[model samples]
Target: MIDVEETYIENRVMVQPNHANNLQTAHGGHVLKWMDEVGAMSAMRFAGNSCVTARINQVDFERPIQVGDTSLIKSYVYRAGRTSVRVRLQVYRENLRNGKQQKATESYFVYVAIDDDREPTTVPELGVSSDRGERLRDEALAGEGQ
Candidate 1:
């Protein structure tokens, strides 16, 4: 079994002009790319094999991260099946000066572990062994209804 915390991944990116849309905010596509990358990392960490994105659930962009702001992405494997892993990803817009953050977007991603031949392979079970892991799982579950 793999502890949920062991699969947790966090990443930060400064939204630059190239990543921004006409509104001077991070483009939705750019945010999605970051989320997918982080989610894949979490899934691979848990599966211990190369993982491929299978599906992406509803993605809601709550707010925009300005071009000069920071995008904080957090992802963790909350559930796993025989050959699939479920990752919860949340993006936040952070103000560097004030050190404040607000939810920018969130989505659930499903990844399938693959072998050298690119065939699906079984993955270990997911366990919430620590307080942080349990809390993260609970939060992900709570958001499922929305």
Candidate 2:
């Protein structure tokens, strides 16, 4: 019952020279790394505990983001289990000059909270307190093929 909008978080990072590949575009590894980091944040926020990646459901790259473009990554917790949290992430490339933007990638990640002993820990029931939360939950459920 997490508030989808409240769980929604966005982070922007400038594509640095080191983050690019031979083609001068952001490397796939770099993009995945960023997505993992941001997605972990969403899971941690929902679980309120240390979490580890259990799986990456999918990652789709729609466009390349070149160096000097801003990479805006958005993440939110979409579903939860006793010890697992599902997070959805989206990446966008922003053109600073014209203020244009486009989706560069999208991904879904799963994480599980662990206790001090490194065993899976239970998590609180997600509370869908708002319409946005219900909508996100429905979307996530549908994506699960439920």
Supply candidate 2's per-residue lDDT for 31.
94
Worst 10 residues of 2 by lDDT: 137-146
- Top-lDDT candidate index: 1
Weakest lDDT window of 10 consecutive positions for candidate 1: 137-146
Model 2, which residues run further than 4 Å from truth?
Answer: 143-146
Q: For each candidate, what TM-score against the reference? A: 0.97, 0.90
Each model's RMSD to truth, in Å? Answer: 0.8, 1.9
Model 1 Cα shift for residue 130 (angstroms): 1.4
Which tens-of-lDDT digit does each residue in 1-146 have in candidate 2? 45666678899889999999999999999999999999888888888788999999767789999999999998888878899998888899999888899999887889999988999998777777888778877777676542
Residue 115 local lDDT, model 1: 100
lDDT values of the candidates? 0.95, 0.86
